[model samples]
Target: MDRRTALKHSALIALLGIIDVKKLFAASGNNSEIRGFHKFNLGKLELRVITDGHILMKPVQPNFAPGISSTVVEKTLDANFASKSEVDLSINILVVQSASRTILIDTGCGANFGKDSGWLTENLVHAGIKPSEVTDVVISHAHPDHIGGLTDKDGQVTFPNARVYLSRIEHDFWMSNSPDFSKSKITDEGLKKMVVAVARKNITALKPQLHLFEDRAEILDCIRIKLAPGHTPGHCVVQVFSGQESLYHVADLVHSQVLVFEHPEWGFEGDTDFELAVKSRRKILNELALSRALVFSYHLPWPGLGHVKKQGEGFEWIQQPTVLPD
Candidate 1:
């Protein structure tokens, strides 16, 4: 972490100190105030989870049935106090401020996607952050929700000066071919409609900022990108370090908190490769549980901050404690 990033981070949180958490949640209404983030200190580095919005989707199908009984899913939801059937997969964007740079882990679905989605920008501004001030934009994958905010409504670059980093596979998968939506089970028209906000032409032109990176590439001094593929071809997780303390920004390694942990093998129709996604999910979950490092899950309740733990034949996620244990 550098001095400049440190200063910006402190200023942003100090800004949030003025806003009441209850009032922020209340303003969100039915969307469920999932946009506000939780901030944690890693020695000198400051980590804040800025929520974009959420996805209310039906479970991934017959797999969502027997593999993890709806009964268990429902019970888990009840225990977590989350709404049943339609799960709210919250989208969280991470802003890491170290001594060197202010980096955003993944840009959330920008302001134009859906009424419920695309709140990242607004929330960032609310945190007293300017888009232009973001030094590096590290993309976990090229999925619409993760990358749609890369540009604005006018088809212009969203982060004009920031150097955008993405995995080689992720960039190729989305930019190269016309995705075969037929196999996706999602209607072609529907897929087209979903991507209408961020068409190919707009993405093609803004080529300079999007730099393809390989595994272990250091985006900044303390932040390193790891290729945790499967959710998307080049899906990734960013590891942030300051002294001995670290946090992993586990992007899309898990979607619905219940679905991913309780039944790691279940396929999400949204994932490009279902089998590989399961493999990646299980691998990451195991590693997370063992490491016991604080993790920032993009879609695991508001603020999306927690740690994974080993459970009966699987693993359980425990939210990060609000206060350090004495």
Candidate 2:
């Protein structure tokens, strides 16, 4: 080959080497997978957020935005560069270690949900925690995803050594013989009934070690339960305070960062009381935004820790950068 041609080829190869290989692979539909667990410290408290994987859900479902127009939903999703037809919903399980006690905020979907889910146990192992080592299992609500991992397929408690703490109102609501399904806004009546049944069974199985607490009760030294009902009759949020630092676990208060934060008025099908859900979401988000408090959401994304900021009439979720331990 001529010297000029060889120089030109060398320049082209150097240019290709300088280009971002990951970006090129992403353009070709390849991307790196998200890790299953993340850890960060809150003063003296050690917090670990574990992923149970994610599922792709259709955004056009009947109750996704009950009375909202498709045009508005599509525009909001498009603006965020999210999938127009589907949304990726993640399941986050929090593990808190304080004063020699290991606590779990909510269990993830077990073998029952689907193939994509049920990674909580595996991730827990990866985090160097065993089910038997968990001292307490604090449930925010009795939803299928949160309570499904309470027991195994053989109907035995998964956390054999842990005492389960759940809200009194939540336990009663699920155990009630006649739950007021008429008030539910879910479009699929069948799904609503199935969820109720599963919640009831899961709680019943854990009754032996169950310790129900009322609203605003301190379950542990630094952990307190705040009643935030709406998604369910007794849905609650768990707050962990260590010294002056605090981390709020906002469970299912906002499903999608784009849809819920950008448009809090939109109704979610999973919420039994749609209007109340909106009210609770706005009230809590306003407080968090005003206080600039750190938050750990169950469905926002992997690690789900961030701060809420007020934007126009709505709010915005600013995810915390992942920082691994040294």
Candidate 3:
């Protein structure tokens, strides 16, 4: 080998030696405890975002964004430096503490989904919250990921002491003996069957503690349930207000932070009614953008708290900077 080539190789080896291998491994390791929770104040209420990890899913064609072309999807993803093949859909559990109660919105995917998820309980503990301490489990919908953590592997209730709340329409649709599968636009027969079965099993297990409510009802003190039923028969977004400050927990209205915001007309595969899903998304997104309200999106990045802003014909997600309470 030439002297110049040897010198270059030696320089590279020296640089590698200078790096701390152990520390590098530790930094990149999957330490769930450290990445588990985030807390912020909302007036007198304390809001916590408990992560249940994330699922790496391939972006399905047609269903991912029915209105947008494949070329557009590829270009947008590439521009964002996101993987064209797959995207990580994060499962975030929202916790709210008021003077009267401690409410949890949406349980995440349980152990049955995959190993990549089901860390909600572990993270809750890391956040200093006991399952029993949770006064209410307000479900945004009965989708598997949102309600899967309601029961444990033994088919027992996870939050033993908390009262379970869900939209009446959502509960009825899932519990129905004959649901109209045509509305969902799901071509995979096996996947559709699995979703129905999971919903029935989980909802049945929580029936004893279930408290179903209608739209616009004040389920809790300051938290109101707003029916946004396009994702499912009864998907709902929660509005939590204390004085003039408020936050909207928009569950599944926008699946991908980039795709959904940029093309509100795009449809998510999980939506039972694709057209309705788009309508609800556009309506809610417009209102949220106009009001400039802080939002908590379920499938966005971790902590999922952000703001919607108008961008040309569509919108954009502006993630709130992480700030801890005093």
TM-scores of the candidates in the order shown: 0.80, 0.87, 0.87
Model 2: how far residue 137 lies from native, Å: 0.6
Q: Per-residue lDDT for 195-307 in model 1, tens only? A: 63353543574588778889888867777888887667778888988879888988888776665677687646566666777788888889999988888888776667889
Indicate the residue-level lDDT of 33 in model 1: 21
Q: Please report how far candidate 3 places residue 51 from its true position, in Å.
A: 0.3
List where candidate 1 sits over 4 angstroms from the true fold: 1-37, 59-82, 180-189, 192-202, 323-326
lDDT, candidate 2, equals 0.80
What ordering of candidates by TM-score runs from best to worst? 2, 3, 1
Clashing pairs in model 2? none
lDDT by residue for model 3 over 1-326, one digit each (tens)?
86445434443443233432112122233444332357788888898987776776775455577647788899988897767877668788899998778899999988668877888887787677889998999999988899999998888899999999999999899889876768766788888888888789888998889999999989677799999978998999999888778899999898888778988877787789988988999999999999999999998876688999999988999988764321
- Candidates in order: C-alpha RMSD to true structure: 7.8, 8.0, 7.8
Tell me model 1's lDDT, rounded to 2 decimals: 0.70
lDDT of each: 0.70, 0.80, 0.81
Instruction: Please identify which of the two predictions, 1 or 3, would achieve the higher lDDT against the true structure.
Output: 3
- Candidate 3: pairs in clash: none
